[model samples]
Target: MKILFVEDEATIAETTIPAFQKQGFPVDHVETVRDAEAALSVYDYDLILLDRVLPDGDGLDLLAALRRAKDATPVILMSSIRHSVAERISGLDRGADDYITKPFDRDELISRARSILRRPAAMSRRVIEIANVVMDIEARSLIVGGTAIRVARRELSLLEQLLGARGRIVPREAIERNCYGFDDEVSVNAIDVSLHRLRKALVDAGARIAIVTVRGIGYMVEETV
Candidate 1:
């Protein structure tokens, strides 16, 4: 998962950046609300980790702006100064999905972030649908016409990565990270082989979702029609 961390605390950013990166999460950091706004305007982050207090403006302001713009991407607010019940409630009211008090356990923070991401979006969806193909995320399976389809573990991971993308584009880098672990000896041809097999499997199973290769960049899944 990719994240945008809007924090001014040097210590917290320094510690969490590498911690998250170690788990295949790349984090982009911004210390001020203006920079946060700029980042939001350009990039799409899976989750936003925002600080309650910033060098330029209150975190609440940024939250309010996002909501006003109808940006419903999940946001987790962190703060040492405003972790009280009322403060947290206020943040939630302003559109923060989850709030974490400062000095939190990194594991706990990661868990909360993943939990939010796992839940079906009220505005979008967790289970992806294209043509007749359904990705049943809860069961970690795929189905077409109510029949289950078996996919290899790594290939299933690849499918989930593509289907879970809010945007259709799934970068080659992300596919490599999600498909193979550190101990696995993976090569450039690994993705091509996996895609070829997966494409054939889905076709044989009668799915109408077309996995389109974007030439040099990545892949996207779309309805065949």
Candidate 2:
């Protein structure tokens, strides 16, 4: 999954970005509320990690704006000053999916993020099954026609996006935004190359599925009839 991390503290960001990366989640970090808003306008993120104290303004204002716009993207509010029970309640009431105090354990934060993603509002599950392919998301394992196959991280993310859509066309722009971090140096044909390799792997593993390319548009996953 992709995350938008809004925090101004360089030390905390330096420590936390790698933690999420280790779990295969690409993070786009913005230090200020304005940068976070700019990023949100450009890309769709699976989760948002919002810091309550920001250089520009209160993070709660951003959260409130998001809720007002009817954006249901899961958000976890983080703060050191707002760790009290009443403040936490206020943050939650302002439309945060969860509240995490600063000086938190990285593991605990990851666990809470996973829990939020599994909720019905997030529309992600622990496992996904489509045609002869079965993906255990938490395990990061792919089983096609009872045979296991190894997929690169990017391809796995692309597959998850496609499968999650349940056969709907996933736009190329969306794929690029979701599969790669803002700072990642992606080549012009990177998505095509990865998709080609994924298609080859799936076919070799006897998956009864097709990753169809719509000319100049995007791609979709469908069972081979």
Best by TM-score: 2
Candidate 2, run of 10 with poorest lDDT: 118-127
Q: What digit string (tens of lDDT, one per residue) describes model 2 on residues 11-79?
A: 999999889877878899999999999999988888999999999999999999999999999999999
Candidate 1 structure quality by residue, lDDT tens digits, 71-94: 988999999987579989999999
Q: What TM-score does candidate 1 reach?
A: 0.62
TM-score of 2: 0.89
- RMSD of candidate 1 to the truth, in angstroms, is 6.2
Candidate 2 — which residues are off by over 4 angstroms? Answer: 123-126
Query: Model 2 Cα displacement at 212 (Å)?
Result: 2.5
lDDT of 1 at 92: 94
